[model samples]
Target: MPRFPRLTAAATAALALGLLAAAPATSDEPLVTEARVSAHFDLAAGQTPENIALDGDGSADLTFALARQVAHVTADGATSIRATLPAVAHPATPIVTSAAVTGIARAHDGTLYVNYATGTSATGVWRLPPDGGAPEQIAALPADGLPNGLALDEARGMLYVADSVRGTVWRVPRAGGTAAVWATGAALAPLPAPPAYGFGANGIKLRRDAVWVSNTDRGTLLRIPVLQDGSAGPAETRANGLDGVDDFAFPGHGRSVLAALNSGSRVVLVRADGTVTTVLTEADGLSHPTAVAVRGRTVYVPSAALSTQRDPNLVLARLRHFISRG
Candidate 1:
């Protein structure tokens, strides 16, 4: 996660007025309508949602980063805590400054997988069985590294984790065992720290036989092919100039995606050809949106409010359609 300074009262007021909108969308940009906050979270209680996983019935599983809890939100906006990660005695996490639960993925069997970065030995991937037992650490990741993104390949019984600090992707067995570095390269490494704290691979998703990752420091989206033998192929840039991009989701069965620009407080639709379209912004109730998930035409975006410290929430929007430019 990238750290951002809090907005001044004047700046916040301007943003609320839509005077400081993120790069305005062109006529050719994708149209997102009926954008509204579906669920409001408590900023003081640390209910800021960092990432989301959608269930079959329109419910959502969310990782409340600062709260260190995994919660459920129903289609009608009802929210409840599903599980809470164990608290650390002396918290000392890298970059973000606190122990947190980040990315999440739900399995076909109703199992839930999530990443926790505690800067302690307990930092790793955890599993919450559908039977409602206590969540347990399944794989151990580097205590110094920030595991921010997680994706499950259910058919292959594998889990892919994006380590923001280590600049690597680790592969862990679905049954809980030793983890292995699946891929690493310059494309995944964080930018040299004159800025002091920068994240490398922040978000990840498995789709269309490839693993897509977002590099926050590099401000780019990358795609690494899954070779026939299940090895990672060369990494290629899909889109760039997405400064502050944290997490993203494919809205349709297409190459285009809606990405969360955390620092920019906006969500942009990146087309197949890499053309970027500003769709949702701070005016639409996004308080530094951290991740996106879509089910049919319904889009779910969770805001962490790391900078805003205001209304951290889950916003729902309708993906109307992309405007075709002739």
Candidate 2:
């Protein structure tokens, strides 16, 4: 098991204090982009990138939301196919019988974890080996539930999954076992009425001893503590008012996070104390930015461009200049 290093207690406290003393974010004083590091590179026409996971060597593994394929993008902007899913069925009852792979997580040893559902069968969590072999089913969820986000607590040998339809966060062992509901609160539930996005907990990440999740339709961020007994504590709000919070990334070792404002078509910096900073907006060239992956100084953003497919591409930004060590 492997764990991402976290900010020291003192450093995290300092960031919270800094955010408390800073002024609120506004359009007129937005956080500007430091630099664009990667050249825009579009995928094959008709393909849309969904989730992203760092491959430990500065490269990233990407999932296609429409195509049945997974791809790898290098630091220089080159892309290559890694895996593809077989044709799946559709049940007559549900409007949607199948969903493309929408979430991906890479283990310390390079294995990839993907989330997808096919018709009325139980949703399968497939594991892809690093050496390029057929994917194997490691875990399964209810046929009606939709798993949207995945987070690996490598140090604890646990995999945390966000079930968008069920409005629950499930905890499953990495080595395969029964998955149980680990955390659930009002924040994880979907909007009360129809015409809603039908999304609840959309993004999940494990940092230190806490597991964080985002509510897409509600635009809220919540987290729960992982107790010594390997059980989850109560969920608490970390931030709110994000119009379309999606997948996010924690850069370096700080408490601040970069979250993709999907419907807002922007990426915003969320400080420790809930202060928000508009990092990149539509004016800076973004179209439905869906997921963010941070590794060292580079922040990788995969824009779905569902409406503006003509310019669909991945954007990498240099961030050392804008991020504060505290």
Candidate 3:
């Protein structure tokens, strides 16, 4: 599971109060509507979906964090295990308790790439072939760091990995080779040790000639330009005040984004102007929502239920007033 900061008694109480005090939708037409649980996962079986990758057929591929399995869910909500990573004997991971799969990206040819944090030399990016055979490690990342979010640039044949523990973004070739540090700065660094388990860069995506990242500890969304020479330019803060922001997806053609606030147990819409609108909350069956994926008019949210420990499931919502770019 993705590491989270240990909340103090007062902080926990404040979160509860904040959730209770959240204002209801005042807009005549809400951005998200008709939210409902599409599939309920078995928490006892460690089937918590951490991140999501959508297929063209309205299906989704998810990384079952603690289960170390990649699962496929049909449009009708039926689930099947696609691939499972090998179990680690003993892990020396920091903050996070066990070894598991965190992020996943599906290539155009049906190839699946996932990040596995085993706290050993085996920790790195692994690739599952389209033919459904065994998976193999494609790139080697830091053994001590937690690789949380992954994004594939199919056109460029590159993969960007977000390391939550190390506070860095790594670049790896799609053909499989050594990983290189693409970007690192204070914006990506975790907060000092007071709260503990403060994850830095949690979620990542490549969009519009730039790489976007979410800082879970700092609660900020950042954008780094992809320079002309294939190098990273200056990092800019695109949005802030988003506590517990995890994986996000850009819906439609414009700059509007749908982000998951894991600790807040909410999914919000961050507009192009930087204003945030709380679109979905706990009442929408969000139990520690970990990621957001938009396919056509449907928005998919996978709740890890790490804190709630209730229903770890997939919630589907309709995107109102959305116009597809394609």
Reference-based lDDT, each prediction: 0.85, 0.72, 0.86
lDDT of 2 by residue, 158-213 (tens): 88998776788988788876778898777798775355656788888987899888
> Which is the better candidate, 2 or 3, if ranked by lDDT?
3
Candidate 1 or 2, higher TM-score?
1
Candidate 3 segments whose C-alpha is farther than 4 A from its true place: 1-26, 323-326
Q: What TM-score would every model get versus the actual structure? A: 0.90, 0.84, 0.92
lDDT of 1 by residue, 65-145 (tens): 888999999998999999999998876677665788988999988999999998998899999998888999999999999
TM-score of 2: 0.84
Clashing residue pairs, backbone N/CA/C < 3 A, model 3: none
Best by TM-score: 3
Which ranking of candidates, highest lDDT first?
3, 1, 2
How far out, in Å, is residue 52 in model 1? 0.4
lDDT of 3: 0.86
Error of 2 at 174 (Å): 1.0
The full ranking of all candidates by TM-score, starting with the best, is 3, 1, 2
Best by lDDT: 3
**Per-residue alpha-carbon lDDT of candidate 3 for residues 1-326, written as tens digits (9 for 90 to 100):** 34443557643332211002223335787879999999999877778889999999999999988788999999999999999998877875556656779999999899999999889988999999999999899999999898999999998899999998899999999999999999999998888756645689989998879999999888899999999878899899999999888999987666668999987799998877789989999999999999999987799999988777689999999977673331
